[model samples]
Target chain A: MSMPYWRAAGMTYVGYANACAVLVRKCMKEPFKSQTATRERVHFKLSQWLDGVPQQPIVRTSDDGGGGGGGGVGKK
Target chain B: MASGSARPGSMRLAKLLYGNVNSYLSSGAAGINGGGAVWGSTTGLSSAELAPFGARSASGQIVRNRMKSVKSIQKITKAMKMVAASKLRNIQVKAENSRGLWQPFTALLGDAPATKVDKKLIVTISSDKGLCGGINSSVVKYSRALFRLNGLDGPDKDVKYVIVGEKGKAQLQRDSKKLIGMYFGETQKSSICFTQCSMMADEIIKSNEYDAIQMVYNKFNSVVSFQPTVATMLSPQLLLGDQEVTGDLDAYEIEGSDTKEEVLQNLSEFQFACTMYNAMLENATSEMGARMSAMENSTRNASDMLDRLTLTYNRSRQASITTELIEIISGAAALEG
Candidate 1:
């Protein structure tokens, strides 16, 4: 069976759909453009657990600029 | 002899009037002390303040402190309400728009009824922070009810849970610790994007153990109401095997060169992400709405409490002043005599 473009490109359907969503958010007009841009920004705090105890967290923040896809699980 | 008799009679009458006045003053003082003692418990006044006449100042001090705290609390709730209101407005629009991404899939796939599924995965969506009224609890209760309905009487062997958000995990952990397969957190700290939902969906799909996945979330009905809703997505294998789904699939023209099974698999995965994205947005919107109403109620309560406190403070203050004036007037009359 022939593979879909995303599948051939080594990306899952979810990754393709998310990429499309990001593209759509970027191509919008002003006001909502900035709004979705701000909305798309992500902030996360990563912490490692050892033997049922949690260590200090490391905070990470990123702004997803127009289709510059970062790590899907780690950054996005 | 006549003047001596008159002076003794007058002295007896003077003593009688003074005794009556002293009793009246003491009785009035007793009433004030009683009020002070009752006020002490709520106002957190020291025992020393229960002394005669000292209660007036102490009572005023306590009322002021209470008013100050109430005013601050009111300010906080008011600010929280405003924040929730604005956030609701923002997320509500996004939630409405995101519904378009999944509604077509729902129409195409139809709902896969939960009656005969062998392995079921329930995905519950909740928030991290609380004080948002009963939204989280309602979601949890709905999931529990679902568990009960699915014949999870004792050990919950065939059923598993994929909890999204910290609140859901915290709550579901108590009863079904072993039943939880995965947990996701911090999805509500900022705006929930499609990527995050996609990532969550990917992880859930990776497990590939369940025959069907049921998503439980709070559906936004209006600014004041939300309903606990469950939407089910059948696995690709289940969809392919079902004659009704296959019949529905035949209606749509397949554009890609891939086999029908491959296309169905891709569609199923994509649909999972879409549903999850929509559900997260809807739950987030509902959470903000719940919080807005909660904060509004609290602000109103704080103001009402402040009003009652002010009335009591003013009444006691006026009473104390009147009592002092009475004492002064009685003392003046004795001196004049």
Candidate 2:
């Protein structure tokens, strides 16, 4: 795939993602658009990722024979 | 017989006086008339004795030369204005496009709590080229105000600076030589790019000298208006510091093996680059806008000067022609007599 303009322009992944997030926030409609809290939440999340925050494990499977049954333990 | 002798003697004296006057007149004494009226009535005098008419032609030549120079200057100013206008349009679009990257980042920073730091780095953005109306001065003024507000004056001042552009460096060097940590002069030589911003960020980050960084730049408001603005970018320590951790921090979930510290470091670097890039874009746009207006003013002034010069040239030319005509008519009248 061709490099994106921001990347070609030397924007880091965090920078590019942050811009996309902001653009997304701007396009949100109605109640979602008016909700500053949600927008801030998105901004916060995007910033965290942009800051290179490590991804949390989505599912932590138990190793004690209850593996499949306790797979959803780390969900937040 | 005695009366006859006396009359003859008187006539001889009269003839001698006339001969002396004729000789003087032939020697170009008519030039001393000072343009009032050439003594064209003296048959012994030549038309060359009319020095004022010749001087008028010389004066006309000087006026024509001045008008020519003004016309060339007007052409140059008009071309410069056109070039600036086109550049302004392109830069404005770029500035607008980059808004998305920085606006949200700004909002996030805005909500964060302020953490006081001892050593602050201020980055002043301006362009090397001037003749733009106070564009560089505005940033310089903003930086000065920042120093004053933070009490960053005198020997004990803890503020440091990273100045981008020769204009800002030259201005700030007068007062803040000790405070300038680094200077970037090449960015304004050509259009600024993210690579330049990255290089600047690396320098600032590698120095590991300051607690926080602030960018002072001219923000493009419109073609005719711009304002010096300050955008603060927190250092890694400040970004991850407990004091700056807001309620919004709980909304994000990190992934992978990277620790918060690593993430913060990377984030700070990325944010630094982004912020610098954004500031550069805005400053570039503002510079172009300022230049466009400045060039427009110059072009207008040049045109005004050309108009005035043309009027003077025409008037002088007409005056010379009238003088010559009067001289020729008087000379002809003298010849007829």
Q: Which has the greatest DockQ?
A: 1
lDDT tens per residue, model 1, A1-76: 6677667866667766666777787789998887766545654443333333334644434544333333444232
- Which parts of model 2 are misplaced by more than 4 Å? A1-76, B1-54, B111-115, B152-156, B242-246
Q: Which 10 successive residues of model 2 chain B have the least lDDT summed? A: B35-44
Predicted model with the maximum lDDT = 1
Give the Cα lDDT of each candidate. 0.76, 0.64
Candidate 1 chain B weakest ten by summed lDDT = B36-45
Estimate, for each residue in B7-85, the C-alpha lDDT of model 2 and write its tens digit: 6668887786687567666776546654334443332234443445536565556556677776887687678778888
lDDT (C-alpha) at residue B124 in model 1:
91
Interface root-mean-square deviation, candidate 2:
17.9
Model no. 2, DockQ: 0.02
> For model 1, what share of native contacts is present?
0.24
Docking quality category of candidate 2 according to DockQ thresholds: incorrect
TM-score of model 2 vs. true structure: 0.66
- lDDT (10s digit) by residue, model 1, range B7-89: 66688877866665566566566464466554443334565545556445876876788899989989998999999999999
